[model samples]
Target chain A: MTPELPTPRVTVDADVLERNLQAMATRAAARGLALRPHAKTHKCLEIARRQVELGAAGLTVATIGEAEVFAGGGLDDLFLAYPIWPSPQRAARLRALAGRVALRVGVDSVASAEALGRAVPGLEVLVEVDSGHHRSGVQPRSAGEVAVAADRAGLRVRGVFTFPGHAYGPGRQRPAATEEAAALTEAADAVTAAGLDAGVRSGGSTPTATFTGVAAAPGAQGAPTSPGTPTSPGALTEMRPGVYVFGDAQQLELGTCDWTEVALTVASTVVSRSGPKVILDAGSKVLGADHQSWTTGFGRLLDHPDARITALSEHHATVLFPDGAPVPSLGEVLRVVPNHVCATVNLADELLVLSEGTQVDRWPVAARGANT
Target chain B: MTPELPTPRVTVDADVLERNLQAMATRAAARGLALRPHAKTHKCLEIARRQVELGAAGLTVATIGEAEVFAGGGLDDLFLAYPIWPSPQRAARLRALAGRVALRVGVDSVASAEALGRAVPGLEVLVEVDSGHHRSGVQPRSAGEVAVAADRAGLRVRGVFTFPGHAYGPGRQRPAATEEAAALTEAADAVTAAGLDAGVRSGGSTPTATFTGVAAAPGAQGAPTSPGTPTSPGALTEMRPGVYVFGDAQQLELGTCDWTEVALTVASTVVSRSGPKVILDAGSKVLGADHQSWTTGFGRLLDHPDARITALSEHHATVLFPDGAPVPSLGEVLRVVPNHVCATVNLADELLVLSEGTQVDRWPVAARGANT
Candidate 1:
């Protein structure tokens, strides 16, 4: 009998993914906060369902297309985590989605809040707060003005949320998490002072999740320990951790997770071996070109941890081993841990879930190309 | 009167694309070489047709799936420019494809050559040559051996091809191109000395296409000259320049083309503007996470060149502008030049082409997800 042909595939260690989900859930549970894992990482219904089963209070989505897919998959409470602008076309879709699920949309500006209120009469809006990332969100001082605008537009303004994205870099997570809590807490106080019910103060990144307590530690003066720590479990009602679902090179670099916890990898074959380089069928297209300067290469070869994929083309990856390692022979399959697991999954149509190294099932990357 | 909704888009400057095609064709024609532009970049039938019209002898594809698409589009002569080990399933497809078009497949090993020969009799094979990129291809000294194996298996050995992928990095292109020409010339000599018709001595990348000259120049003995130069017109038979069709951020970074030459961009909206960061609706999901460290951000904004997209999530690009520049208003549309144009195109289902900034036609990215 002939050997089977190697398929262009993404393999997920189901047990690892499950453990990661449980770990994050436990972290959030211990703090009495809601765990709303962002579905943008995996984009697989099975993973989303597993996250929900692991005690995710709600699902966070980055796009309406993603929200639609998760909602269609029976996830009733959805948060479109993006500050969606109300286009008439998207507004109709959001209205339809609102009818089916407990929908909460994100907003960072008075204009967006007004537009949302005009487009969907009874929409629940969350005032986005700028944590240390400084990406998208209102300043804590300006959160009240945006919340007041939302109130005037007849939209119910919920509490605040921030992404401690700055925690992603080296040695920045702890300080960033500290700043994140302070930013959300300040924003929540502003909203409450303005006579609005600041029901939720949400923030958490995978790298900062563990440092949430550091922000809550008290000083001897009977005052708050540090603004980074949450004094009350109800201070921030929710935590959103996406990449924890599939630990990637970024997560490893940030020391958020270990190699054993990396649940996703691309299965590729050594198609050619010449000189100091071994070429694999998986290239930038399959493994994804998401390398940072600190990353060893585009990805790490699981079979040889020290081997670095020095370069990648559309369909070929050039890997270099630390001198004297046995070169991979032609047709030998190898697993590559992508620099960014999220980008890698976006390239695949389906993901093969494995339990104890045995193929369990295949799940479509439902929102794989839903860019719009 | 209601204005027409803007379609999700990526435009091809037909004139620019044609000029690039003609330029490469003229270079190959002058070198007495055949021109086979790689089709993996655009992956559009229309662009492939234009390439053929501009005198490309055939087309180069990265996958059998891509080859099938072009073959079905009436392209009779093609080269699957990948070192694919032909399994029975792919072999059957190759045989079926052979019946439709003149197919040239790449092989880097004696084993793969034999497998191809056994899978599809009379298949035309090209011994892949490693010209210093170290991505794929066999060593120059091993070319004859692989050719002999292919011949022994009753396969027709066509010549050799190497991608000077190393030319992509900073200050490495000129040296890499010199090595590329030397490697290909050496491989061609080896093949001919082995009593085989090395009909094609093919190797060229967009960066090194100019450095592949036979004539000597001041301070540059045996240094490759631009393929665009008139002095070395008959040096190589075929040239594969794919990204030239749709100039990307990489092209700009390499100084290969100017920003004005960029033909494709993702149309996105300013969904949020809070604090110092402005969020765009298009993120890694649309623009793709193909950033090289040197790249300013995930992508360059067409209208706001000074604004750097500091961060990108799956559905959000967080852009930061310098202190004085006008922040993009909420709901404002923006065009983004992605770092890797090919990857971005692959992430979309369809592309809306514009003529003079007015939407004219829409083309499906036919081979969008053909990673296999």
Candidate 2:
């Protein structure tokens, strides 16, 4: 009895969401790791407040705008986990944000560290290291130099962090988790040798979060080279997994979460049907256009496992059903899990809350377009 | 100067935008086609008003929410150019919208046509016929049956439309345009034979818009068959091009537009610089992640043409410059054109207006995230 809401609407099941939040929080606590869940995935203040109530250390945001939103919602501990080159305008906003919360930012280069230090002096900073994902981060060996630069620029070097993004690839989750741990450990050591308090070595992505710090977990093949000595300042100290809160088609395909664990889904209607293709109203605008090369399709139908969304237009999803599988009739509502939950959530202004198959509340995606 | 705003800001060059609007309007006027520009690209009320002022016949939208926004913003006519499956909730909204605006919707099936007729009897409906892109719509020969169903269900069959989406492929613009004309003509003939008023044979996409209705124009390679006899109900009477307002990397690479024609770009700041990779703050979040396999990369830099965005995270665009190309320093602002303009504009809250290289105003994307 999924509520008959508008098509292409995002719906979050409250019952499953509580489980997801508690499960991740419990997992991180058992490993003695700080749970600073990435709020960029679910920009809802309700979700952030719940995460905090579940014992999360803080929240990790991708932009100063997001940090401001969450900080204004009364979250005290906020971290901007991006190599921010704050202009005077963003610097002023960051200064305002820092005044109300325990704000921390990421620094990957000396120039950015200096600019940030000049913008907001005495801000806590984390040296971003490349954990085999060479997008935007310094090498683990060069962390000491960047930390030294931040220290000289009047910023406190807290520790280091790396995103194990490569874990999303096939069969690379454990190896990426191991590389992330090793990179964070090396970077933390570098910062410590530079006479800075490198107490936080953070690393995690949804694919590798389950085995990030705890080597011998409940269902792990092997450990990631013994994730640093426990309790050491250089150990894996924090996890910032974003997509775990709302398991998506990617996480399900990667075996990170089962179908039962998904909390958020797009409710769409079968708008048109051809020979073997069923078009859903939910397309890239609602389900997101994140079709990973390794993924099976654009997304998956939660109830109809055999249905695959083969292509997407602005507002049309071309779903292909297997030979004898039943394709939904026109106007029939169906549940579709997005390929990437974060991209999907960012597309909608609000998410419909559901509990026990009944409509409950509506949570506004307050930071839906907080891109600046 | 580009305003000292935050990184990853979307900017609309007002001068270039006006030129683009006029260029398309003029082209349509010369071709005798109704210039119903697709408003989904910009979603700004100011741009829509300017388009109306430039003699546009009306606006085309992808969703009811978008139609509602434009209609509320003083647009009197709109067409939802998709096979929409309106449930009761959406039917109510559409009913309300049609009460004020000259609203029309697309229908490819008798079921949807009858449903729309029941929801709003006497409403004008367009039979969507497949030209070449088989994502949605019915075969051209089958348009009459759906039109007949709408006629019997208390709805007016106003015309037929086909989206020449295959024109986006490498050298298929002319072929797709030909296919669109031939298909629309056949569908309109079918509807006319069924005693229906098939006056509007609409078709166009950005890549194929210029060659859609006109036989020979400024840059015509050749003519696509002899278009239906002028003044006939089966003639191509309208063009619906969305991306012309904001020329993107896709349009530039397709040769539909030059770099100077680009009106919108993401103003990003260089946050980190690796050996050959320069990371900008504009990522998939700001610049929508619509990377077609045929495209060169995720996006392109407007000023530094040699630099290609190799990869993108949520908040980092990994740009690679060829050897001998001068890379911008950290904190240096640069303009990166998105691959798809429609998706890019949907991601931002407001567009920074620039006229003659100076800041003007901020236009909110009135229909952004209006995914109902």
Candidate 3:
């Protein structure tokens, strides 16, 4: 029998997690791409270990604090996937981390590359290119400038990386993956043309990870990336998709995965039922307040698909059930899938592992507050 | 000498914080209302101690986990202001907390009242009334039924509480405060008519707290609650506002506080400057992704008020400066004021207290992950 846990807790279905891990690992392996699952999604050392056990090359993090947490936990190979500004405090931490692990950081500007090089000379760095996100990365053609700056500053320029963040919207995965590959190829040429070896070409998001290489199938090993495109692989050497292991409402609504594949959910109890509105104890504090424009609500009820979270307070999620449907009784436990899994995981300190409706284990979110 | 801190760090201006605390305390004292600052805003025991030293009645929390953390830190008077569904696990914790401190809980349903009464008989419970937010609290007229049930179950039904959440928007504070007063008066009458002592009529929000009584001035004290209405005080006995201490974008937009009064900000470094767009190290992970419709952007730059954070990834904030204006130089330090102070504080594990640009002290967010 599984031990009863508290409400408003993040729970991971053990079977679903295993299947997701194996599926992503197998797909990346079949395409001959290194799988470096982004630890920013789960922030759990146990899940990172599972990913490594499934043949992941390394782990990707967004902050130096995350890298430190994962590295301190004995996971050596790490890549910080953001253009980190090497302040004096972070520089010392990065130098310490680089001394201990195979560390590679992302750089998008000459200023940042020089600062990082000054902070830790001979540090391995990757030039970040903008596929379409237009958030942080430089242009594909401009990658050479940053790489040359890093090389001139005695920092080893390893490769180019791009985040196809625009692929997050509905029905944008296939084209975004194609765009990512083309951008990586262009950036790699730029880096190599500047007398720097672009050893790695890294790019992938959760939505586009399923179509990373041209031959990746929906659920199999071989299929065309698009309807008319042939299986001509490009320069992306690795895939870094974080949210695949724990499918969220965004992925579910985007049709990236089925509801059964949603491994993570917030277990909440119905605290108040007023007419058609049922309030759950789980709110933004537990599920995270990441409401995308395309998201129908803050989150969706796992058991009752028709129930939509109309509003969220700090500690109360007001869900409105469809008319004439049987409302959930007060104190009835319900599972809620949040809009974004990474933000939700960041809000939690640990994840409750559930096996067949029973508590199997607990996984601490090791880097939960590693926001530096 | 000021020690270098990491970028995207939560820093509090000591002078601004002291002013905010003293102003709120003075206002509450002048109005003869108990000021129980919501601990969910800061979560730092040092800040809570400052509020208590300034004559706060106690503290208000959102969860039992927070209550437990505060109780362990030697804060005796605490209130959990949400309709908590007492599970066996939480029930045990609440029982322990009740035994250690003066505990008060919010109740809105018969089932929760009965369960709470059984779990900890004779515990103090306040009936939650929905003023206007339409979120968790019960209807103004239905407080008697729940109060009667609590009485029958041997629980002490003391007074009522309403969160004037509608006052959060622009130009709605005074009207919403009036609405809150009417609702609290109606609910208090119901509870008193049910043979329960309605000793506490608590109603508040950050925006409406300044207008709690009808005599609050537009920018001072002694103004009517609404247009053409006389300055007649209603049934609200006390006020609970969390965000007045650390003003946010929403508060600034609503004219509740000026930019100079904003006490907290995230210290970020400008890592990338691409034409008109500037990228900062602070993103949603540190500042929180709580964007209200009325806010200008994800956050605003404290130094350069014209700059707007147009986009936010997990680890980067893309700020857009006004065209023709001198942009921030690369590696320049900037302070970002987030949209929601409560959510922002919840995301941080600690706050750096700065006085005259010098790091004076550090305060741990003692209940950062107390979300159970």
DockQ of each: 0.56, 0.73, 0.69
Best by lDDT: 3
Over the stretch A1-372, how does candidate 1's per-residue lDDT look in tens digits? 324545466999989988888888888888788899888888888888888888898898877888888899999999887788888877888899999999998888889999988999888888998786777788898899989999999888888888888887888887887788778878998999999978878788788887763454454236755554444434578888888988887777778888888999888877777655778888777777777666667888766878887887778888897778888777777888888888888888899888887887889998887555
| lDDT ranking from best candidate downward | 3, 2, 1
Kindly report which residue stretches of model 2 are placed more than 4 angstroms away from their true locations once superposed.
Answer: A1-4, A215-234, B1-3, B215-234
TM-score, candidate number 2: 0.95
Restricted to chain B, the TM-score per model reads 0.91, 0.95, 0.95
TM-score, cand. 3 = 0.95
List runs of model 1 lying over 4 Å from the truth.
A1-5, A213-234, B1-9, B13-32, B170-176, B209-232, B274-277, B293-296, B304-307, B320-323
Candidate 2, after superposition: displacement of residue B201 in Å? 0.5
Best by DockQ: 2
Docking class of 2: medium
Per-residue alpha-carbon lDDT of candidate 2 for residues B1-372, written as tens digits (9 for 90 to 100)? 554767788988998988888999999888788889899899999989988899998999999989989998999999999887768887888889989999899999999988988988888889999998998899989999999999998988899998988888788887787788878888988999999988999999889976777533322433343544332222589999999998999998888888989999998988899877899888777787887888899889999888899888788889999987787898898999999988888888889998887889999999998777
- Please tell me what DockQ candidate 2 reaches: 0.73
Query: In candidate 1 chain B, what residue range of length 10 has the lowest lDDT sum?
Result: B227-236
Q: RMSDs, each prediction?
A: 3.6, 3.0, 3.2
